[model samples]
Target: MGRRARARRQQQQQQQQRGEEDGGRAGGRRGAGWDGGYPEIVKENKLFEHYYQELGIVPDGEWDQFMGALREPLPATLRITGYKSHAKEILHCLKNKYFKELEDLEVDGQKVDVPQPLSWYPEELAWHTNLSRKILRKSPQLEKFHQFLVSETESGNISRQEAVSMIPPLLLNAHPHHKILDMCAAPGSKTTQLIEMLHADMTVPFPEGFVIANDVDNKRCYLLVHQAKRLGSPCIMVVNHDASCIPRLCIDVDGRKETLFYDRILCDVPCSGDGTMRKNIDVWKKWSTLNSLQLHGLQLRIATRGAEQLVPGGRMVYSTCSLNPIEDEAVIAALLEKSEGALELVDVSSELPGLRWMPGLSHWKVMTKDGQWFAEWGDVPHSRHTQIRPTMFPPSDPEKLRAMHLERCLRILPHHQNTGGFFVAVFVKKAAMPWNRRAPKPQGGTGEPRTCVQPSPAEPTAAPQEATGPSEPDPEPGMPDAGVSASPESAESDGARRDGVCGPPPSKKMKVFGFKEDPFVFIPEDDPLFPPIQKFYALDPSFPRMNLLTRTTEGKKRQLYMVSKELRNVLLNNSEKMKVINTGIKVWCRNNSGEEFDCAFRLAQEGIYTLYPFINSRIINVSIEDVKVLLTQENPFFRKLSSETHRQAKEMRGQTRYAAPSCCVAGGGRRPCGPSCPRTNDCTTCA
Candidate 1:
């Protein structure tokens, strides 16, 4: 047999062996790497023919190669989240242990190296496996590698999904102080990345910057919470909001109601996802030209909202998984035209080194499936069909179009990076967007409260106990995600009016967060309760005493929580501007009488890292042996602490009872409590 035929036989035979030996077993079809059943037989739809024909114009000779590459599954890729406690250590283990097992692995007689990190990714945190996941699981030598993925992902040490999905976060270049917004964050792979970057400086308990992760679908926000909880960053606030009409929020800073804005925004809008043909093999059959046509307005509106919310000089990344120019360059072109020089496509040529990419198309045409060609917007069928915007068409003046510089946008073809096709366009807000003069504020909107959607907190399931079982639901960037929203056909119809222009209605009135009174009411500085706990923990009086608040929720919020002054400003100032879903961290808690300390406020485990440096007393170190015992205890109390711990606890006695400090070993260093930490070791507890 020839090389191709022999390779096919080898692949099939190995698959058969795997099915027999481990098919229904640990790493099988119903396994961690397996994304549901085998990929469906997807074929091109006729409706998408003209769409491809138009894409062919700018791509020139590369069109055939691009289309052919999407036929196969994308290589699995994941990035270790930054600002995580065990990030570097986990990366070390992967390189040495898990990846080492794949050193001698081969599939279809093709030698496959262990998962390799992205050359452009800093610190080698992002990794890519050259082969599709199916082949990887079938290979005998790579079994342990597969098991590693299942385990590590469940433990939140790794995220497994698609390669191209990792691009937008890298482009955002989040910092420790930049307040960020994820407009359509769901199954929050990128949201988690942004959270990590927000805390990348490793500042604990709080970040000067915060991430407001929002999704249109209220149900999918649960998935987003699941993803966000893994990072353990207290700075994230998940909300449900429609991207296009997300309400404006304001903070009263210096007696001015400053509009709540983000230093960076990620608008990974909903798309038809034709570029996802690799893993979502069904896209081939489901592909339709109308998918982009219907979604163009939504994408345009979402990106525009993102721009409006962005600070001047702030950057917003507009991305889509579809390869269609209508969804990619066309929407960007629309936003630029409407921005009136306030938005510019940023050239990120040097951003991700060693990344193979093509520039965005400067020229393309719009064609209907009916073989009708629109030479220009004027030629579009206004009466026969809905009017299409000028931005949807490549401008008649080539110079003007070239000046738009859409080429700065990055396009990742599957063959170029062994990844799925993706389009990413970065725009910097050069100046405040000139609001349309025709747009009017909602009636009764002045100084009146609007409706609100209040959702109960989303409690995520505990981390996976074993790695080699059903694949955890922790989807990284890439692959089909949870339900994003309604379908495209209905989306267009719901979004359009008699003119067929799509625009979701804004809030009928200004949003009021149902605040008759401030919740973060300040406790007097000299309150009787402050001396015992304050003296014991040695808290700085300089810390904003007013930002601390007590709440009734005892589960996760505990009894006492502290919001950073910056974050508190946003929360208080924007009470009428938008719906604030969830915010703040459990910095301190009121302990029951049974706890080790009678003090009402013991430093919460999540907030300890950030608060520890500020605290002056009530800290005791124990041996590693004691640490293990504290972590493993069941009664939520560490009764076996050394003399150092007992003496420290006695200093802050108040309604005292022993309780879990949640202190557990992390990075072989004394770290904050984890979920697995029973909060038993109260030694680190600031009572």
Candidate 2:
């Protein structure tokens, strides 16, 4: 065979072996090729093929290539956190150290493709590798690179994400002072990206804006918290709520209560994740028209709710992992119709240059599960109307279709970019929705009070357990399988309509479910804890002392967290109305052994960056060699250190921290300290 044929055969053999070794067993029956396991999942579904074929989304002569790409395993992709000072350093290390080693490496006689920088991602921070995740783990040649990825990912310096999944956040154009919301954020890859964008300028100790990440499943909210905690951002808040009915919250604006509308909203709503089939093999077996048909109403509801909660000039990016029009363009069309011109689709063709995508379809047909097709809503029989709604079909009026500008939306296919399919539609709010044209009334006005039953004092205030393994397989950003009814009554019900009204009066009691979170108790400015910490660290007087808070009310405060002044305002005003699961970054922890040092609280690595700017004293600068020794050795005596470091260590009387200049560690002088120890008075490094 020729070289190309040999490589293709080798790939097929590896795939066959993987299926035999990993496929789940069925009935424990041993057969000639079964090994007591189930047959390999056939990556073919007649219904799926027929449905898409009818949609005619694939370009001419590309149907076979599209199917082939979908069948192949997805390549691994990762993104370096661009806001960090060490981003360039990480990129350099990957290029010179790890990828260079793999230049001549081969696995099972198949040459491995060197990882390349994604052309669209700025600064060469994002990368694409042809190596499958399984090969990265099993191939001895790639072991070192795999370990590097693991370490960096855990440290929040990098993220292993799907390439298409990174597109929505980039389109958001988040800023440090923009109030943003992730309507269905979980397994928070996109949410962390937003946090990174918010802290793009590290000089600002605390950004004026915050991100509120919400999800309906209470348990999944904890997973979202765990992922967000890695970034150590105090401005991000986790809330448990049905996105379609998320309560409108109030925030203090210039000493007056105002309805809180997000400056940017990411409405990546739940959908049938047919686009993620390349990675999630189960999607092939479960793919059907019913999934999208059942989810269209909920998707529309979430998108409408997002538009309602967005500022007049704000932008909302509605995205989905499913390429099905029922879940992509159909929901966008319904939302725009409901808005009555309050929202308009934005043409982002020039946003991410070099990206491969097709314009959203202005004409498409919806199909029932039993091979029934409808070109218009009126074609559906009365009995099938409950399952298929008018919004699921394309508009019959050519003028209306042109006005919707559905073609502005983006649809990325697997073949064009060697990536999983994705859909993104950007909407910019031009005015308030038709139903919510009036300004929000002040609190305690005609609106009924929105409150939840308070948790008892005995409830434990412990943090959620840390994620043990790699991020749990989240359904492509916002793929929830629950709440999939698409009946017309449910879509047009008064409850759903009221949810679209900005700051509407509570139509019904808001039920609070899941574990009750500990109350956020703000520290009094005169609290005894502040005096010693301020004096010992020589903190600048400009710090907002009152922004410090603890989760406990009565017990000794063991950890001190600080939020931006903006987040504090949101928490104080909406605590009763919103289901806040967790917020705040731990800035200080009580050190029982440090009582003699005149300060009981020591700096926490999680919040060192935010606190570093305000600390004017007790900082000991060390050399790069000193940092290496400190990290390598448990206890290195002063004699082993350089002359200057030794002298500085001797001069310090109490517990001391060491820091190396950013330039010495990462070749970046934008910050004073290294990435691992941005600011510290002791030998312990910051994350």
Candidate 3:
């Protein structure tokens, strides 16, 4: 056979061996790499297109291995605390829920395990059981995969290593009411996860609390905001800041060292990212023996900073996506050395099963004071001696003096479970931490940074002159200062009307919709909330017109008043009576007396998505029923006009002489099947 065929055969043979070994076992028995059940394009990058064409996957399964590799085990050490204390309650819940395997296990002590290897994370397993304390619930997904775990949980089968992702939320509950600091939180998966955990518990002991998620880059802060918003948690505060200065944020309250103390902190620092090679193929391309050692200094600084932020007895978790000893053990060693006996690596082996890895190193080497090399690889006497060899910390050094200053610590890695490579080291401040005893809170004397609230109704214009009538002369020719309102006479002439009928020239009013607080709709100083351009409108039917809002008088009030400018120059102008609203962050309008209406909103991009409510509108986060009612009511004549237009268009298109009326060509010709044309059967054609 050729090389490719031989490799394929070997892969198949290995998979077959693993399948036979784990065939009858429950809870997703692990044997080897991937079984043949997975797509073949996943194994080789160059063959992606071949497999995609044959098997039907886009990009030929580009991220196949990165995503698929999560199933593989990593040597990890998991430590679980809260679960052990709640083991009995968990067992009872599982038993009552009809989980026979859980009911059969021993639950007398801190933990209870089945003879079967746990398919779920020990923490998540505990949480699932805890949630079931009140009812018998079976997860259909988990139950379908691993029959041995909890014949019930098979239906809920998520990957086991994903449990590492759940730790923040679970711990957040166990330690609700405590301040949190997530150092190096970017692309904030863990930060948002923590917020979600806190949201899970409504009656947290402490009502006033927030988590500070910090990273070195401003761009990352924006990304963090996006993640936090999606999780919809109110407690997150994204900060673009450095981690090394965290200790300086510690403050003194009375003498107890209470200010700026976090109950839980996570230091998922940057590293060579070796452990994550499964998902991050770039790491494999970029990997080098020197990278981990290079990042060691930065890692140590961040870990030390986390230690400094911990409250007396508070806990911190330092983690990374790299598996190198320099990035993991060496950094922890440096932290302990700098701490001077204030931190301790706690024994976590008992807390989590399937995570029995090595402890922090001690007794490693450094350059001797006599300028002599300690390792056998050292020292060309005088010629090459000019170049300094890298120094090392003790392999078994516990930094006992440094550890004596704190309460606890633990570590986690991926090799222990078939998941992306990762590492974590947990530490706790002593009940009376020894670091600077007291420092100022990071917020400074200015008080905590408050969110920029949109101006309230009562706080209309900052200056009365800014909200005054537009009676002033034009100071700079055609310039109109921002806050002036439109003339009452002009408002009456416009066919577009809101609220009641037009009153006298001086008393005419413009009423805004969906306002809970303010009945009077008027602009003050140029409202930053309003978009620059307003939609056009016309009273006459079938006449096209466009309108632009421009300052009529110069001064502060010029920001408020605007006159609708007609656009007779442009053909088929959208003549809609547009009202821009502050809420909904969008502009709503309807053509002159026409039922068909359009709503527009600006996205992160400068471009806009103008939605036709009358069409099969694809709106989000709102009920379709409610949308239908709102659209129909706002555009009373929309249905009649839309149906007539649709029928006319169809009739025009069906006429062969017209060659299908082209919306783009206007005069009618065959529509070109350009880049967006439907080559395949699955295309959803749009005009």
* Number of the top-ranking candidate, with lDDT as the measure: 2
Residue-wise lDDT of candidate 3 within 488-512, one digit each (tens)? 5434443353322111122122222
lDDT of 2 by residue, 362-459 (tens): 99998988888889988889999778888888878888889999999999999998999999999998986776544333334534222222222222
Instruction: Look at candidate 1 and tell me the lDDT of residue 434.
Output: 63
- Tell me the deviation in Å of residue 74 in model 2: 0.7
Ranking by TM-score: 2, 1, 3
Candidate 1 C-alpha lDDT tens digits along 447-520? 32222121112212122221111111211111122322334554454334222111122233313422122133
| Candidate 3 Cα lDDT to native | 0.39
The collision pairs in model 2 are 656-681, 656-682, 657-681, 657-682
Candidate with top TM-score is: 2
Q: On TM-score, who's better, 2 or 3?
A: 2
Superposed by TM-score, candidate 1 places the C-alpha of residue 52 at a distance from the truth, in angstroms, of 1.7
